[model samples]
Each structure stands twice: as structure tokens, then as C-alpha cells.
Target: MRRWLVLGALLVLVLLVLAPFALIVLNAVKTPQEYAGSGPLSWPSHVSLDGIRAFWTRVDFGRKLWNSAVISGAVAVLGVLFSLLNAYALGIGRIRGRHWVLAAFLLANLVPQEALIYPLYYLARQVDLYDTRLAIVIVFTAIQSAFGTFLLTGVLAEFPPELLDAAAIDGAGRLRTLVRVVAPVSRPTLGVLGTFFFVWTWNELFIPLIFLISNDRQTVPVALGVLQGDRMMDATATSASALLGIAPAVLFFLVFQRTLTRGVTAGALK
Candidate 1:
């Protein structure tokens, strides 16, 4: 009886989570007139690609997708690399005040992005990086690295001491052990970190909006925001754009779902 009740609750939770996405997919294929006339929850009478086509053409979605991919990919790769180095130094190395360093990284992650925007903006202007993709890439890399370090630190701290000793006995240098031994064992954690950084950077709007002033340089989230007018009424197009915006992150998660589960579970087991 208890197991049945738990399964029932989970089924309800899944429905609640999927409801909005189901609505978006349903309305994305409907004509604007049809969508406005029908209830949002109602199914389309006939499927058509008109709405999505219009959104793609008007928003130049392909270009926005390319820009977002480049920025998010760079942020993910660099963030994971920097985080691994920091984690190796703090978690595995014989460093002083390592606990304090980990605490600092956690505290940095807790700082809200809103509070730092002004200083970042000023710094960007001074450095002449304003309105550039590189600016977003650099900022996101730093921001995500904090959280990545927090996660990877915990994973690396649980590494078997015997293995490290053995590697040392084998005359493996710190860099070599990190590259050959630590990295291979930490691939699962790396996948989780990279996926998270990619998704967050892909969906970020505020920083990109403020820093990437040029339309061509804007990411998918910021580009979608531009489509909204004071009295925006194109429901179908809006839905289509939103679906497109989330698609990449959704696909990324789906692809790495197993690795993410393994990474989280590995940390917990350790």
C-alpha cells in the first residue's frame, strides 16, 4: 500500500512538471489565429509548421543558436578545466588552509550575480570588452567555475590515498597523475559539471543582455527576449521560440543523463 501511494505521488509530480512543456509543444504547431481563439490547453485541430517557420525566419534563430553554442561550449570547457585544476590543488595536494579555500569557493558561488553586475559592467567598459561574446564567455566561465570547484572538490577529496601513493612511487609527477590518473577517474564528475555549465550559460539572459549589446552577439535567451513587445500577442510564435530556446539544453541533458546520475551517485557513495 505504501509503495502504491509513492508511485501515485510520483506520477502526479511528473504530470505537473511536464504540463507546461506539453502545452508549448501543442501550441507551437498551431496558427496564431487558431491559438488565440482556442484555450491554451486545447489541442490543435490541425498541425502545421507555419508558426515555427515564421519564428525561425524573423528571429534568425539559427544564428542565435550558433552564438549560444559557441559561448556556452567555451564556458563549459574552460570552467571544467579550471575547476579540475583548483580541485586537484585543494582536494588532493598538500596545501595549507585548504578547507578555507574550499569555503571561499562556496561563498563565491553564493554571491548573487545581480550584486556583481554593476562592477562587471564597469570593468567590461574599462577593458573594452563590452558588447562582445568574449565578455560573456569570460564572466560565465568564472561564475560557473566557482560552483564547479565546489562540486569537484568534494569528488576529488574522496580519492583513494593509496592510489596517489602508488602513483608517487611510480615516479608520476603531480601534473602527470592529474592528467593520466585523476582525470580518467573523474570523467563522470566532469560530465556533470560540463552539462550544468552548458545549460546555465545557454539559458542566461541578464548578463548577456547587459554585456552583449549587439544583436549578432546575443545568445538564444536574450534573442527570445527581444521578440517580446510591450503588447506582444503572437502566442504561437512566442511558444515556438521558447521551445527552440530550451531544446538544446533538453537534448544535452538527455544525452548525458546516465553520466550525470553516475556522477551524483558516485559522490554520495564516496
Candidate 2:
């Protein structure tokens, strides 16, 4: 009876989570006339591709995809590398003032982007990095790395002393040990971090909207958002936009599903 109840509860939870996406899919296929007649939750009489087509063309979605890919991918790779190096120093090297450093990173993660936007905007103007993909990559890399450092440091702190001793016994220095021993041991965690950084950076709207002013450099989220004005927006198009914005992120999660699962479960065992 308990097992049956648990299964029933899990099924309910899954549906609750998927309800929003299901709504997007449902409404996205309906024509504007059908949508107006039947409302958002009602099934469409026939399928329509107008909203998706219009959105895709208006935003040059292919280029937006490429721009987002570049920025998110660069931030993911750079964030993981920075996180590993910082965690190695704080956790393995046991450097002086490590706690203070970790505290600072935690505080950085706590600081909302709303507060930093003005400063970042001013700095970008000064550095002449405004309206560039590089600016997005650099900013998100730092933000993601700060959180990654917090995660990785705790894991590394519990790392086995025997492994370090073995590496040192074989004449491996700190950097060598990190390269040869620590990183391999932490591969699952790193994959998890990279996947997270990629998706988080990909979904970012505010910073990219402010920094990437030019249509040519705009990301998928920003470009789609730009299209949603009184003239461009309609109920069907809004539904399509929600679906469009979430699709790539969902696809990325699916691709890295196994890695994320492994990382989440890595610490489960003794």
C-alpha cells in the first residue's frame, strides 16, 4: 500500500511539473482564431505553423542559436576550468585565507544581478565591450564559476589523502597532481557544472538584452524578446515564444542527461 501510494504521488508530481510545457505545446499548434475561440487549454481544430515560422524568420533564429551556443559554450568551458583551479587551491592546497575567499564567492553568488547591472553596464561601456558576445561570455563565466567553486570546493575538501600522497610519491607537483589525479576524480562533477553553466547562461535575458544591442549579436532569448511588442505579439505567438525559448535548453539537458545523473549520484555512495 505504501509503495503504491508513493508511485501515485510521483506520477502526480511529474504531471504537475510538465503541465506548463504541455500547455505551451498545446497552444503553440493552434491558429490565432482557434485560440481566441477555444482558449489556451482547449485543443485546436487543426494544426498551424504560422507563429513558429513568423518568430523564426523575424528573429533570424539560426543566428541567435549560434550566438547563444557560442556564448553559453564558452562560458561553460571557462567556468569549469576556473572552478577547478580555484577549488584546487582552496581545498587541496589549503591556502591561507581560504575560508575568507570562499565566503567572498558565496557572497558574490548571493548578490543579485539587478544590483550589478548598472556597474557592469558602465564597465562594459568603458572597456568598449558593449554589444559583443565576448562580454556575455566573460560575465557569465565569472558568475557561474563563483557558484561552481563553492560546489567543487566542498567535494574536493573531502578528497582522499591517500590519493594525494600517492601522486606526490610519484613526484607529481600540485599542478601535476591536479591534472593527473584530481581532475579525473572530479570529472563527473565538472561535467555537471559545465552543463549547468551552459543552460544558465543560455537562458539569461537581462544582461544579454542590455549588453548585446545589435540584432546581429543578439542571443535567442533576447531576439525572441525583442519581437514581443504590441505590433508583433499575439496570443499564439506568445505561446510559440515560450516553447521556442525552452526547447534548446531542454534539448541540452537531454543530451547531457546521463552525465548529470552520474554527477548527482556520485556522492551518494560511501
Highest TM-score: give the candidate number: 2
- Can you write out model 1's per-residue Cα lDDT over 1-270, one digit (the tens) per residue? 999999999999999999999889998989877877876877888997888898888878888999999999999999999999999998898489998988899999999989989999999999999999999999999999999988888778989988889899999999999998999989988988999899999989889989987877888998888777534538888788888988889999999899899978876774
Write down the TM-score for model 1: 0.95
**Clashing residue pairs in candidate 1 (N, C-alpha, C atoms within 3 angstroms):** none
lDDT of 2 at 248: 94
Q: Whole-model Cα lDDT per candidate? A: 0.89, 0.92
Model 1 clash tally? 0
Candidate 2 Cα errors over 4 Å, as ranges: none
